[model samples]
Target: MKNINSKKLLPINMNSIIEGHMVIIKPISKKEINKTYLSWLNDSQINKYLEVRHNKQTINGIFDYVNSHRSRENSEVFAIFTKKGIHIGNIGVIYDKDNKYVEYGIMIGNKKAQMLGLGGEATILMFEFLFKNKGFRKIFNGVISKNESSWKLFESIGSTREGILRGQCICSSKKPCDVYLYGILRKEWLNSRKKYLNILKNIKIKNG
Candidate 1:
C-alpha cells in the first residue's frame, strides 16, 4: 500500500459518532441480515474463537438474532464496513448500565479482512465511541489465551491484564485454555489515545 492513491484511502461516508481514517463504524441494522453475513458465522475457520463455534448457525437464526438486536436497549451493536462500503465484521458492547462499564466484542469474520491491522483500528473506533462519546468509565474483555493478537490489541491501547483464569474455558482446541481478562479506564485511554492513533495513522491498510 506504499504510495497508494489518495482517493482510495478517503472515507466514502462520514456519518458516525466515531469515524476513523480506515473503517466506518455504524450501528448494525436489520438490513445486514442475509446469507453472506451468515456464511461468516458458519465458517469454522473464522468462527473458531467465537462463542458461536459450539453450534452450527443458520441464516434464519442470524436473521432472528439481528432482529432481536434491534430491540436491545443495553447493547450497542455496530457493523464494520470498509471505506469502500464492504460489510466485513461486527463490533458490539454489552453495556452494564448499573455498573457503568461495558464488555467489548469484535469479529472480523472475513478471512480476507484479517491480518491487516483493520481489526485493531475497528477496536479503537469503537473504543472512542464508548469512552469519548458515551463517557464510559471503563471497558473490558476476556481474551482466549491462544488468541494472542486479540488481547495484544487491547494491551497496545493501554489495557491492563487484570488477571487470568487457569483453563477456565476452551477455545480453538479440545483442551481447556485460560482466558485473559483485560480492562482499561477512561483516564488511561485519554492519556494513550493520541499516541495510539498516531501510530495507527502511520500504518497503511492494504485493500483486500
Candidate 2:
C-alpha cells in the first residue's frame, strides 16, 4: 500500500464527524473498545463474512489494530454510531493516493443495526465524505459472493458490479467463494446522489 503524504491531503479536521439522518461516522476512540465490541468480533454470526473471522480476536489485538490505523498515513477507521449515539459498528478506508481511489470495508456488528438500512446511510455518508471532501475519484468495495446483503447495500447506493474474482476468498463455510467487486466513480455518485438519498429516506420511513 502506498503511504499517504499528509501534506497532499486537503485540510480537514482530524476529528471529522459525518452525520446522516439515522447514523453518524466519527473517529473511533479507545473508550469505544469494550466488552460488547469484543463480542462482536468473536461472534461467528457477526464476523462470518469478515476476514478477521479466520483468527481469534482478543481485546489487546483489537486495540492494537485500531491504534495501527491511527498511525498509518494511508488509512483511518471510524466507529459507526446511531443518531442516539450508540456505537453499533465500524467502517474504515484505505487511500491509494497515487491512483486517487479508495477502498473501504464496513461491519454492522450490532444485530439490531442490521437489515434496517442504517448501513446504507452510513455508507452514503462515508462516500460523501470521501468523494466530496477528500477528493477521491472512485470508491471500491469487495464482498464475498455469499454475502448478498453486503453487495446489495453497495448497489442500492448506486455502485456498479465491476467484476468478480472466482473463488478468491475462503469463507466461513470452509469453502472458497467468489469475491464480487463493486465500485462507483465520483461523477456517477454525484449524479445519482439525490435519487439514492431519497430511497434511503423512504427506507427509514418504512422501517421506522
Candidate 3:
C-alpha cells in the first residue's frame, strides 16, 4: 500500500488504552509469514467460505502473491496475531480508485480463532486507522449470504445493508452464492463508536 504519509506515521504517546483481549491487527511484516501461516491458509476448515480454495497452495506462490502486492497504493493487508504472538488470520482493505471507496475483507485462518470477538476487534482497529490515519471517506464490504457470523459482525459495527448481488460468487460446487453489500460512511462510523463499544462490552459480559 502507499506508504502512509510520513507525518501520519509519526510515533505518538498514548495515555488511554482500549481494554480488551483480542487479536492485534498490524501491518504485515516479513517476519510474520512462515510455514505456519501457509499451513493455516491451506486448512480446509479455514478456507471453506473463501473463494480461493483450490488444490494445495505452495509456500512460494503465497509468498510471491503477498510480496508482489506489498507496494500497491490500493490495498493494505494486516496479519492478525493474538497476544501470545500466534498468527490467527489476516484482514485487508482495498481502495477502489474509480469509486473512491474502500472495500474490506478478512479471513480467520485458524479455526480456533473464529467467534472469539477477535475479528470484531481487528475490524474496529482497522476502521479507525483507515479513517483517521488514511483519510478514507467511506468503507464497503461484501459478505457471502451463508456467512452469518461475518454479516453480523459488519451489522454490529453500524454498516448498513446496501442490497445484495444475487448469484455473484461461485463456490467449489460451481453453484452460485449471493453476496450482501454493507457500507458505512466516515461520519456514520464516528457517530456509532459508542454503539460499537457497547457491543464489545456486552460480548465481554457474556463471555465472563
Candidate 2 vs candidate 3, TM-score winner: 2
Q: Is candidate 1 or candidate 2 better by TM-score?
A: 2
What is the lDDT, from 0 to 100, of the residue 7 in candidate 2? 20
Per-prediction TM-score, please? 0.83, 0.86, 0.79
lDDT of 1 by residue, 14-123 (tens): 12544567787776655665677888998878887788888988766764554343344456566888888888898767767688898888999878889998888888
Ranking according to lDDT, highest score first: 2, 1, 3
Deviation (Å) of 104 in candidate 1? 0.2
Candidate 2 to truth, TM: 0.86
| Candidate of highest lDDT | 2
Clash tally, candidates in order: 0, 0, 0
lDDT of 3 by residue, 89-196 (tens): 887667777777888899888778888888888787767666755678899998988888999989988899999999998765668889999999998888877766
**How does candidate 3 score on lDDT?**
0.69
Which whole-number lDDT from 0 to 100 does residue 94 have in model 2?
A: 74
Can you tell me which runs of candidate 1 are displaced by over 4 Å?
1-17, 67-72, 199-208
Best by TM-score: 2
Worst 10 residues of 3 by lDDT: 7-16
